[model samples]
Target: MILQLIQVSKSFGDHQVLDDIDFELKEPQIIGLVAPNGYGKTTLFNIISNLEKPDHGEIMIFSEKNTNEKIFEHLAYLQDNRVLYDNLTAREHLAFVAACHNVEQQEIIEICDRLGMSHYLDKRVKKYSLGMKQHLLLAIALISQPQLLLLDEPLNGLDPSSVKLFREIMTELFNKGVSIIISSHNLYEIEKLTSNILFLHDQKLIRNTEIDVPVDYFYFLSDIRKIETELTKNGFFWQSKNSVEFLFTLNECQKEKLEEICQSNDVLIYDCIQKISKTEAAYFSLFT
Candidate 1:
């Protein structure tokens, strides 16, 4: 195990945040931490980083080589609220981080180049965009070479291409035996990045199970794509509606064939989210 939390607890005033939290980190795996905001996910990261003392319980790890000597040495956390010197140029910032850790200047430059941060290295940190800042932070984290890397919503504010690139980098890192722990609510991101889910509900882990994408009716998606052509060719009696999500009424045989096609395409029907119905749920979570 890389890291373990045994029955951890924390509170402020009368409000309890983390309640008897127990979890472990295994190497060569990417763990997804999913939960509502203000549910103590970040708080737990703080505790693990030794930023705050736990009220009770223990964070235990097996004694390994150089493990106890630097309990935090193997842990690197990129908090949601990013930290950077506003006055420093991006290159200066990277250099400063490298100096702090005694990383070679050549290695720092190589890391910046590899991450596509070279062009903006000379730009002032305050002028850097969110994506650039995130890249810089990730570079710093990688330089430290922590066995366990914890990121809080790393994909926030990134463009689609950047998100895709970041996912690729994460996959590459995991392949190299780096354990990643990320907290995100974006199911699409989770579905793409992880095989198991650490489903957090009400500040306690309700489940940690394999992420199963429910099977979708196979031919349904194909039929929808070629609806006009298929309609004229098959001469089937059916109805269609497009108020919001795609809707169709097909007879038994058509429905069966559609299911078969969709299943073959790895489309999961039950995972489809109906946004109109979920609008209320979204509003309450955001405003209430």
Candidate 2:
């Protein structure tokens, strides 16, 4: 196993963050850590990285208790850009991480090139834009060639092209047997990356797999009661958003039945939108 957590719990005085969280990662696959802001996603990452201790639990990395610093050699964490030094250039920062990992200078250059940082690698971090800084942070994370990578909001401030590049690199690393856990608010991108999801809700962890199920449809209708009655009578799963809005999960035949009901009853659907992927559907079902 790559990582295991047993009865992990944490709190800040009266506010409990995580409660009895148990998880195990046994293979090299990309998993998305999902939760709203201030929900202890970062706290869990910190505990796994050994930056913070769980109030009540045991953590093991690489089949060993996370007590020795040498075990960290196979792990890398890509946190925020605050770890960067404004006075130094990107090359300098990469060199520091390379030296720590015994990586060669040539490999640093190759990584910079791969991440499109060779253009401004010599420029000071103080003058870098948010996207540029994000690229630099990614470079620092890749410098060590770790077996396990923990990325907290790595997609922040990245443009579309940069995001594409980041996804490509992550896929390459996963193909090489590197386990990755990434947290992002972009549910669409998360769906594209992986189907294995770890959700933090109600101070506990919920694991979901094979999330690419049927699409969910959200409809704003003129007659909510009629639609609700029809859906319930037909044995379709649905949730009422409000007086006018309703969300439904329907199969092909169920969808045709819904269309027939609307047409027969003259229920005008003012607006209709589909939750393109199950990831967004799951997010809304869990949190909203």
Candidate 3:
């Protein structure tokens, strides 16, 4: 296995963050880590990177026990951009990393070129925009040529073009046999990257696989009681409702028929939203 976590557990005082977390990633693939804020996502990444020791657990990487120094040889953790130094140039930042990791300077240049950062490689980080800093952080991570990469909110503060660029870079790395675990709040972006999702909830890791299924449409209305029979007869189920509107889930094929029935029954349709993916639906189901 490329990485394995056995019986991982961590607690701070009385609050337990993770409990008996066991996960394995054997292939070169992308994994989407999903969880709410303050749920120890960063803490888990720290433990894997050896920045924090687990209260009780063992971490194995590349078929060997991971040591503090040795793991950095093959594992790259692209943490928050706050770690970047404003006084240093992008070229200098990558040069330092290359020197520490014994990576050739030429290789760093190649990575910068690949990531389209050659133009700003010599520019001071203090003058760089958030998107530029993000690109530099990714470039620094690539300098190590890591086999296992952990990225935390790498897409944050990036523009639409930058986001697309980042996605392309991730795809390229995966194609080159790099196993990556990305934690992001962007569900739509995650959906495009991988179907393998790991959700952290109740101090446990839950694995969910996204599969092909019929898309569900949620209709919002003032009151469904008047047309509840029409909805149930057509396989619609009450999803949620509030003072403003009630929401119900129906098959995409039933949208036209539903509208027809609602029009005839005087059921006002405030809005109708086509659900994107089951993963998104599952995420909303947990929080909403």
Candidate 4:
């Protein structure tokens, strides 16, 4: 494994952000961290980067304990534009990172070209747009060629073209055996990147698998009140009921059972829709 966390916990006085979270990742893999704002996604990244000491437990990178100095050598974390010096041009920023990592200048230029950042790399960061800044941040992370890459909201303000470019670069890096962990609010983009997802909820880590498969069946019943008890008794939770009808999320097995229940209860089926991706439904299922 490239990264592992064992019983990690962190708290800030009244708020217990992370609670005994255990996670592991292998090399050359891309994992998505999905959560809402203030859900300790950033806190987890900080702990991995050794910016904040965990209240309890341990973090291991490449089987070595993650430390402050060692992380700078083997890890590259792209947090936000605040890390950028507004007065420095993109080239200057890249050069500074390259110097710290002992990367050659020509290699930095090549990375810029590959990421399509050569157009505005010479302009000061203050004058660059959000997309341009995102490009710079990604380029800086790539310059070090880090064995473990941690990206927090990397695609936040990128345009369509830049988003496509970022995905391409991420794929290239993954192909080269760079283990990456990305935290993003973009569910669709996350689905496109990887199926392995770690969801943080109620100060705990929930590993959600099979996120790549689209839900095969979604059923809406015309008379939900007639079979509400039977549905819940069978361990199937129906969605909202504000509409005249009710929607129930189900899988292939549940669909078969639902058909039998509907037949017995005489519940009229209004619609059956096939979904393209289950990421959204899976996300909301955590809350509901």
Q: After superposition, how far is residue 236 of candidate 1 from its true place, in Å?
A: 26
**Candidate 3 residue lDDT tens string, 10-103:** 9999999999999989899999988878888888998988889899999999877766478788899989889999999998998898889888
Report lDDT (Cα) of residue 150, candidate 1. Answer: 83
lDDT of 4 by residue, 17-103 (tens): 999988878657888899887789999998998988999999998878987377667789998899999999999998889998899
On lDDT, the stronger of 2 and 4 is 2
Q: Model 3: how far is 114 from its true place, Å?
A: 2.5
lDDT of 2 by residue, 1-288 (tens): 899999999999999999998889999999999988888988988898889999999988998887669767988989989989999999999988999999999999899899899999999999999999999999998999999999999999999999999999999999999999998766778778998888788898877553334567997889867666766787877788998888887645677788788878889879878866556666777787
Q: How well does each candidate superpose onto the true structure, as a TM-score? A: 0.70, 0.81, 0.78, 0.80
- The whole-model lDDT of each prediction reads 0.66, 0.86, 0.83, 0.83
Clashing pairs in 2: none
Each prediction's number of clashing residue pairs: 9, 0, 0, 0
Ranking by lDDT: 2, 4, 3, 1
149: Cα error in model 3, Å? 0.8
Evaluation by TM-score, superior candidate among 1 and 2: 2
lDDT of 4: 0.83
lDDT score, residue 106, model 2? Answer: 95
RMSD of each: 8.2, 6.0, 6.5, 5.4
